[model samples]
Target chain A: MVEHMGAQFLLSMTTGIFIGGAAGYLGSLMLSKRMALVAGPLGHLTLPGIALALLYGFNVSLGAFPFVILGIILIWLFEIRTKLPMEALTAIVFSSGVAVAFLFLPIEQAETALVGDISRVNLWEAFVSVIVTSIVFLVLKKMYSGMVLISISEDLAKSEGMDVRKYNLIYLVLIAIIVALGVKMVGGLLTAALVAIPAAAARNISTKLAHYSFGATIIGAMSSFIGILFAEISKFSAGPLIILTNTGIFLISLVFKNRGRR
Target chain B: MTNDFVLKVKNLTVRIDSQNIIENLSFQVKSGDVITILGPNGAGKTVLFRTLLGLLPHEGEIEWKSGIKLGYVPQRLPFIKDIPLSVNDFFKLKKSSERETKEILDSVGFRENLKKKKIGDLSSGQFQRILIAWALIRNPHVLLFDEPTTGIDISGEETVYSLLARLKQERNLTMLLITHDLSVVYKFSTDVICLNKHLVCYGPPRKVLTMESLRQLFGEEVKFYQHRHG
Candidate 1:
């Protein structure tokens, strides 16, 4: 099975596991904070950068970084200055990002930029994805308790002498980096599905935070692997297939959750 | 500046969107004093507490005697039921050990084996008690409560107040409480501060909680009932 598929397919699969697992883990924190709704907009915000990168023949992930970081900063500043809810701030910033992308990107490359073509992934992109994913996972592990405490109550976290603002900024930066890395393989439109669906599925079956996080990672990795395999065999787009796989897992978990209640 | 004063606020002002929520407020909190703040809705009680805790950006001096730890029990725990957190998991935020958690829960008179129970499953009184236990685990030099008994019943309110009074005596802890209930103001407080955006009066409950001040803080429609206790 390994030898039959070409190097590009294998590299894409490897990238998928690392990115998917990391997204799943971070997604659980986002869900707990009631910030999951921002994930979609943040993902879409990467399009302008990817479009500019393709136009200029630079690394798409590298190009996506500046825009995503800017978006995160804008959202953070607006949240603080206006005291607006994060979802609202994200919507405002993301709509502008979409408008910007349409301004620069040609019609021919728009579909590929929107849905992604993982089969075109090269060795270096795969390697960068693995490294970035590892860093994301490690940072999230160290900050897990602090993040959960903040989500529980910012006032409580503040009383404990924890810098809630610093942690919040770090969390947004991590999400931006992950979105940048994922946009190349999953496409800007579908990147949030990688972050959100597995976590939603995991929450259905999990009774503890630790279990929830671990379950999300497993579900994410499984979906990415299976989706990539099926897409290769059927000549279908890998991004939507992966999301569909995650949705299927969520439905199955919901059934189990309802049974447990009984 | 003296050791007897646990906290001193000098001309503290908090302005949000060009509106002054707390303006030119100054007070000194002595060690081992139970100071309760009485105010009507939107009187900036919560904002004052947040300013003192350094949670909000404010203009003025809020000086705590060096190294005095502060604990806070918010008006209510927000969205505890919406999250799937257990009591034990909630305690773990403090990084307390299992033994410490059990001891704190026992101190708050929660005798059930509720460590594994979801926080949302607990009754309002139980949840409020858990918040108290959480604050106690820190062994704070001063504890702050913002409308601690808001959702509790009348009987449960008595229990919570009595428990707080007992804890204060046992631990020799200074307390700052925000409340609208006059009974709580008279019964538990060593000092009362009547506030409506600024300090109306501050002194012993009998001196400061007069009908004239109540009318000024609340409206002319306000009625005062003095409780007689043996």
Candidate 2:
């Protein structure tokens, strides 16, 4: 039994690291663009997709795919139709989305926590997450130049004849997709923490934008892997432990950075 | 004179937050025409530059016919410094030839060694020169500068103006320079526009900058100084 638990821990740790790395990349891109708050909303709103998929007898993650797309469309429409800033729109979507998920909750939800709950993510799930994370990272890397240009000044970008609107919407959708895929291992509540904390910590230390991206990815993987190990030893929830580790790193980085400045 | 005009603004008026910063301001800049836009600190010079670039909300038509692209040197260099952009990366943004970047930097009196250096690490004067080089890399047909010499020291200001003179001579580029530098105005400017939220004077340096006209533009506090050199 001890050996079996150890094997399960190793698999979870490996899966957690790859998914965390992808979250870090997404978060880094958002931070560079000064839009770090979008992560939480995107992550939470992913639940409706998972729930609806389960209701239809589909794979929970697969059901999440279309709902993620729908969420992106809704966000885009809100952006165009409403005067609200992106942050406020995301918050509204997240709260309403979570509330809607509660509506569909069956009495037995207390037992299963939703149909076919992903309490213990297996090797196949982990493998799929790793592949998805790699693809997301590669696509973002290729568009780094255009992304940087947009981040600095939209006016400059427009004068250069870049399609600023398309890039922004596409980027938002990409972020949503990444969050949707990462929902199972880290769960919705803590998934965005993996993205935001590592990137925020990296931002405090990195002088260059590119360096921040690289540093965030490294820090994210380390925290997730270490947190998994700690959870195994302490018999605590892996998700919360991973989040606490990231939060610790963030606070520590902030303290040291401020002191050095003084 | 026909060959000198690089930029032409017609009936230009810019509104910000319901306040009109520039009103019906019109002017022409010929090739190698070093035009100075002089006004008080808050007199809408920067707004006019941004307006002309179609960056800010404005009411006006600005035409640049030199077939020359514009290279902008913004007033605030501090904003650029906060980014971790290397000089090499700045050049890469324009996607210009390496030879062109080297030549432009050389003309601005900046060393090649600084290319790999981050923007924040450069000294004020060094950073200013690099910015000018960034503008020049576009091979601008007309150069639009918004108080390029604002925060620099005397020597740095002199270096920037001298570089402007050199570039103007070499490329016959039309330069629309905005400044509050009274000392160098007569010496460098071929034409000058005196503005106080509206166009008060726009013509040759000697004609538009007369004592009487200066008084009307700057009010009772206006002080006139005869150019010892020009």
Give per-model CA RMSD: 2.8, 4.8
Residue B173 lDDT (model 1): 93
Best TM-score goes to which candidate?
Answer: 1
Q: What lDDT tens digits, residue by residue, belong to model 2 across residues B105-149?
A: 888887787777777667777777776777777677777787753
Q: In terms of TM-score, how similar is model 1 to the real structure? A: 0.91
DockQ of each: 0.50, 0.26
> Where does the lowest 10-residue lDDT sum fall in candidate 2 chain B?
B221-230
Q: Give per-residue CA lDDT, model 1, range B150-180, as digits (tens).
A: 5787777778889999899888999999987
Look at candidate 1 and tell me the lDDT of residue A176: 89
Model 2, position B52, has a per-residue lDDT of: 67
Per-residue CA lDDT of model 2 for A80-105, tens digit only, reads: 67757877877787788778777775
Q: Among these predicted structures, which one has the highest lDDT?
A: 1
| Predicted model 2 interface RMSD | 3.2
